[model samples]
Target: MVEAVFQILRAGKSLELIMSSYELLNEIEKRFPRIYVSESSGNGSPELVVIEEAWLPFMVSLDVMSSEKETNRRKLRGLFDPNGFHELITGLAEMAYKTNSQRLDTKVCVFIPLSLTLQPASKTTLLQFLGNMLLFQYLVNVLEGDFLARISMYKESMNWNFLRECLINMLLASKRVNYRVLMKECLHTICGLYQDYAGIRNEPDSSDEHSSENHNTDVAIALLEVQRTTCMAMQKLIIMIMEIDMSKQQANMLGLTTRSDGLRIPLIEIILDELTYYRKILPRFLQIFNDPKWKLEIIVQYLLKYTAKPVRTRRSNGPSEDSTFLGVLKSFSDSSSAYMSLTSQQQLPGMPGCNEAVIDSLSLVEISKNVAAAFNSLREADKKIQISSLGKEALFTATMIISTS
Candidate 1:
């Protein structure tokens, strides 16, 4: 029966063929589950007993392609309608969770296409792949009494429910000692897919229709699109973080493994390291944006979120933080003697935690000329790109302006 399922899946192309194969597997699963009634134990009583994981080997072989570029091999895409895929994943999750099967993730992760791991991922594939993983994660989480209701409350979109929540939940669950490595591998694989997708978008396409210079602009636009997708997803997750009012629990996801709540925050270093690679490629990617100022401003806005608690600044009789920041940097650079003093002090020499703001009586940004001049000075001296002038100034100015009012 398993051999028949694999053969049908490998050769299946039409929706009818795929659904037939799905039905076959469903029937087989029904007949011989992880725990099933056995023949009578000679005393006319039926035996109900646990069995070895007999389903995993067939699932592992349910590849879209048995070999590379196999003409007959195709994805189960047509069969992956909302209800059908959900049923399939739920079955697999239940079976694997029950038997505690080894390499079960490998079996499940194969549901994501091998093409996703390649370059130039389509939006269709990405969402479908994400949907499938979340489905599997939901099934597993459903068994945990703690997560059951929250998992149920998360509404489904695109036939996949709260992706941000599910992804984080799965990662948090994986952090457990038993499932850690398997879960990590699955995450690393998914990240690798996106990296490939992003990497492909960052490159200039050699198009016959466009000149070489124009092609660079095209690549920049494409890179921006890819960046937007990732950044939007991140923003959604951040909003989800803010929404979580975890006022109670024996522990509100801040557990023994690490002080960091894996559920609340993603592996940021992993993400940032990938972004650093994106940053290295960004200079080329930024060559031909229509609104260069807005591009620079947006990037600065994202990176400026380092301030843990935003504080309003009281009036200072002395020079503003923005004006003094460069002096502090200069002194720190020219004098190795100030290194310890600079870092040790709660405040840096000339710069305050809150920066300086120049505002109108009406509290409007009416200091364009002065601001531009200051910006130029900062830009010229900030060759190392150690800090963003706009970010620092905005932080300082906004806080102070609010305080003064």
Candidate 2:
């Protein structure tokens, strides 16, 4: 029944059918959850109960993927295998990029060829795009439901197995999925949609040649709402993956993770690498990837990559005081002595001391400028962002340093 509803959304036959099926699927999932907590008969304690036979939107298991017939059946039934999931996000990312670049008409049908279409191409395109958006939205909803239930159980049991076996983990672990490419696509899709809806990028031009103005206006409004929600759903998916990574790290620390848990690059590191390579997305990513703890950590790490010394002693287990945000702010002092204090050990032979001093001064100036720009970006991205105590101190330090400089 759920798969039938999903098929309706995938078919993109009509707006009314898509909306109704989407709502019905969500309601059904809510009422018949696959995982939940139930009280144990013996100890009156709550135990995590997973209905093994319950329907899931994902078909990520190796056994299922290994059988061609079974995989085909699942695909026919509208289940998202890992490969299909990656392809879906990848397609969305491409669509978003094209839309942002003004190369792709958002109201033109992407799935159906114009020559073979029975209906008006523009209207078909609009409905198809809306369907894809809702499809991704629903998938994210399912993932969130499943992950949150597992996380709740994990908190009580400290069981790595529960998370290790989650649909998301299983999906990412599949050999058919290119984890890095998938993650990069997700980041692209989120930032592209965010830029479009946030007015940073121009809206796509409307096509009235193939559809009526009234129809276009209605589709435009619907697209706007669904696009915003789709962006939020993408953000939620990223955060959930990061949460799972954090839990896996905790499990490893406790020696609860075994070889069967398998190894995967942490999502935070993947995001950081992507942001580093695609510098244009860094500010937007920092703004929208708003899990405060992770956001702060990413910002600090990003700064340290540019400002900190190239190497640290083996005995140093963590970033030293000089490598911290406060330390970076302090380095912005106008005094050459303050600058020299941070880099004196790296002085080279055959280089004049004055030349070295000039280079270090320029470096300090650049770092300070970057720090200021990053803070400004954060503020621009979110006007209501609350600065923590440490953030406030760092801000104050930067202010004083700027005044003096």
Indicate the residue-level lDDT of 191 in model 2: 89
Off by over 4 Å in 1: 1-174, 177-371, 382-405
Each prediction's TM-score against the native?
0.28, 0.74
What lDDT would each prediction earn against the true structure? 0.34, 0.70
Error of 1 at 351 (Å): 15
Q: Write the per-residue lDDT of candidate 2 for residues 138-251, one digit (tens) a residue.
A: 999888888987888888899988898888888888888888889989999998777766652254445666445345455555666777889989989988888898899889
Superposed on all Cα atoms, the candidates' RMSDs to the truth, in angstroms, are: 17.6, 9.5
Q: Candidate 1, 53: how far from true, in Å?
A: 26
Q: Write the per-residue lDDT of candidate 1 for residues 203-226, one digit (tens) a residue.
A: 554344443334133323333343
Residue pairs with colliding backbones in model 1 are: 355-396
Candidate 2 lDDT: 0.70
